[model samples]
Target: MAKLILDTFREGYGVDQIRKTMTVGELIGFLSDFDEDTPVYLGFDNRYTYGGITEGRFEMDYGEEDDE
Candidate 1:
């Protein structure tokens, strides 16, 4: 199965100060119901462009404060 990730914050600019985020554990919780073999694709730039998971791995960019 294939999964798509929507970009919820598409219109924002200079959002470096915004601290709203989800933790890895929280994200995992959200996906707890999904099958382990499901493939995930990131909806990036727009709904048309997608970033795919390679070898069951993907990278997430986060700010310093998100370490807490």
Candidate 2:
């Protein structure tokens, strides 16, 4: 297992971040809290972050990390 890093910035909500020592499986449940339109940035260990647009799925596991 590795650390789970999640960050987000969206329309209504301001910037948010979460750091936890968990695997991919644990991330799904936590992600359910956000709306489909919510955008998120995900990272594993010390790797580059991936950006994700939560637009349709009720829950998501991955997204491209757009830091620009």
Candidate 3:
């Protein structure tokens, strides 16, 4: 198992973190539980080397807000 810190979306500039020890697949599944449109930050320690904005489900937002 590996430790991970997740930066979950809360609002415009708000974020919450979840620290746990789990496999990468479990971490991915955990991330998938949230809104795919929102950005996420993944890290094991002081630095976040992975995670991004696009979930690979659609084109880039380009600053376009969702119709909803």
Candidate 4:
């Protein structure tokens, strides 16, 4: 698996400052710099999980909140 790093958080990226969506073209542009053989994984709760893209079923999740 390819290791992806997000060092921007240390530069002051927060929930409110992060983008919530990306178009396919935008995604391609963002990933154009990376190697083609890299595996894609989704990050959540500081953990990375392999998205079922190859299985033809991709799931999108926004995570959960305490709502307290």
Q: Which candidate is the best by TM-score?
A: 1
Off by over 4 Å in 2: 1-20, 42-68
Count of backbone collisions within predicted model 3:
0
Candidate 2 Cα deviation (angstroms), residue 64: 27
Model 2 scores a C-alpha lDDT of 0.51
lDDT of 1 at 46: 62
Q: On residues 1-68, what C-alpha lDDT tens digit does candidate 2 reach at each position?
A: 23334643333432234333466677677777667556555654444546444557556535547732
lDDT of 2 at 39: 52
For residues 1-68, could you state the per-residue lDDT of candidate 4 as single tens digits? 67654322222365455556578899889889889877665445455433323655756756567522
Between 1 and 4, whose TM-score is larger? 1
Error of 4 at 38 (Å): 0.9
Q: For model 3, what is the error of residue 63's alpha carbon versus the real structure, in angstroms, after optimal superposition?
A: 41
Which whole-number lDDT from 0 to 100 does residue 66 have in model 4? 53
Clashes of each: 0, 5, 0, 0
- Whole-model lDDT, candidate 4? 0.57
Clashing pairs in model 1? Answer: none
lDDT of 3 by residue, 1-62 (tens): 33334644333442124344477798688878666556554543345454544457546445
